[model samples]
Target: MAGVSRYLAQSIVGTLRQDPTLNPLATLRAWPNLPAEALKRLNQADLSLVDRALEQGGWIWEPTDYPDNLREMESPPLCLFGRGDASALSTPMVAIVGTRKASSYGLAVAEFFGKGLAEQGFIVLSGGALGIDAQAHKGALAAGGRTVAVMGTGPDVAYPAVHKGMFAQMEASGGARVSPFPFGTPSFPSNFPARNPLIAGLAQAVVLVEAPAQSGALQTVAAALDLGRDVFVVPGPITSPAFRGSHGLIRDGATLVEHPMQVVEALGGGMIQPLPPEEGDDLSETQQAILACLNGGPMLTEAIVRQTGLSAPLVLAELTMMELDGIVKKGRDGYQRGL
Candidate 1:
């Protein structure tokens, strides 16, 4: 199907905008690497359906409008479509993402950080899903700050239907709802999995408040890591399955921050920002040893005490506090790390 890859072809077209002498469609047809069969098919293709789809769309982003950070990706969306202020992309952005079925604790954290980040003047970016994503967008709006909702469906289409009013409010309030999909694209479940990275790619950093092991929010982490974006995780209750993936991120050496100011100051102030003492910054030597034991996998109390050469009473006490902090969990089989 490819004499030239879709990405390379799109990149060529995007760059061609700067050249007055070249026509984009003609350049595509003339390229020696463009497959002959593909060109023939495109020529034979009907234009009516394409015209119908464009009617459902809104403003289309010219190549010049693509954010530098996003354009740096191995593969970026060919074009962006949206309503309202696409100018929000020019500002620094921070993504706040989590499970759509977030718990009360997750929702509260998202709200707190969303408002806090926006108040600090960074645009809050998130996938426009319900639960944590919606709450974060609302919190930013409530603080009179700008936010961007990156949607899986078409930019002008509201997928949840319930949030149509909220989307309208966002558009009117200087924020935006945007998508990579065309104007008439459907909100099929498959569309969402690919949308998570757009949230991460647009932002300088990503903050994950909560997610289960299988949460699509984790997809952002993978993309962020690849893009060299720093990821910050908020610790949640170990008893809840909602935080399993979140805690896993923390254990994987992602920074664990308890407040939005930590992220704001860290990003804006760089090394000069003397962050206040947070729980994660003060791990005791005993706690370190205990974590080392559990890092391999779940183990019984006897195994932990034996492995660390610590008395049962001390190990038991440390485990109790760690469990309370949601750093670890105890199951019927053994004590292990938790969300």
Candidate 2:
């Protein structure tokens, strides 16, 4: 329903769902305001087949019942297909978006906010992109809270494909994979940009953890501003190109938030719990020794083994766990503290 106005699209979906005998074509054609493009696309295929497909797979959200915040968008979605319980959308949401090629620091920041906000009972919202977006989802799940993924493709097709397992877990855990794109829609370059507004509109605010000057996360920021929603940015290393857009947003008056609680509290969320345990607090003595070995800065595995006087195999195993826990992150030189 590309060019169809909100008024006509909702009426059609509402009517079509009511009675099977009501001719889809006749109902669609009756709308005097229906654009030629929308009418042509709707008429070319079998509406009965389309209706049946929608009925058989997952669920559909007509415009009439869209999330309240989402209805405020400049161009609200006409319909959405979802693969999990849509009730998660009713929770207060905060959008966290960043570059697909995220840095160690960026990933840490994304996950921190994700877990922090989720623990306080806000559902994290993001596009299911790689890097930052993926970590955000993982963080919420780690906290045993819900998260939502707004997809550029349809609900049935996980576009990057590597995220199939994560998508499955999201559905099983009450989070949703939602999209306005129809089933079988491919990953088009333009589709993501088109879907950014949905992310902005669905969340109370958007947090940009990291992005380059040209990163598309900025598009969501623009959409948030258009809808009069707040935009928050997590500052990254000033010298790095990946942070240029993030810093620019800060300089131009977007709120600079250092942690998830700041965003949550600003959005009026209750403090459900204190901050998560400090980094490295739960580590074994052996792990603490490994941490001490890298006090000067990042170091190679061999160097850490030599300094910690531990076996190389032991150091490797500990380092891997550290990376996964967001305690330390591997960089070009070696592993560095994620902070």
Task: Identify the candidate with maximal lDDT.
Answer: 2
lDDT of each: 0.80, 0.82
The root-mean-square deviation over C-alpha atoms between each candidate and the true structure, in angstroms, is: 12.2, 5.6
Total residue pair clashes for candidate 2: 0
* Residue-wise C-alpha lDDT for candidate 2, range 1-339, written one tens digit per residue: 557666777778788888988887787777777788777766664545456546755777877788778788777887787778789887788889999998767776788788778888888999998989998998888888899999998776786899999988888888988888775556767779989999998998899999899999999999999999989999877789999999999999999987677887788865443432364676778878887877899998889888878887667756755665567779999998766
Q: What is candidate 2's CA lDDT for residue 97?
A: 96
Q: Which residue pairs in model 1 clash with each other?
A: 243-339, 244-339
Q: List residue ranges in candidate 2 displaced over 4 A.
A: 1-57, 270-289, 292-339
Give the number of the best model, judged by TM-score: 2
Models 1 onward score TM values of 0.67, 0.76
Clash counts for the predictions, in order: 2, 0
Per-residue lDDT of model 1, residues 151-213, tens digit only: 998776787888888888887878888887656566767678877778878989999999999
lDDT of 2 at 271: 42
TM-score of model number 1: 0.67
Model 2 TM: 0.76
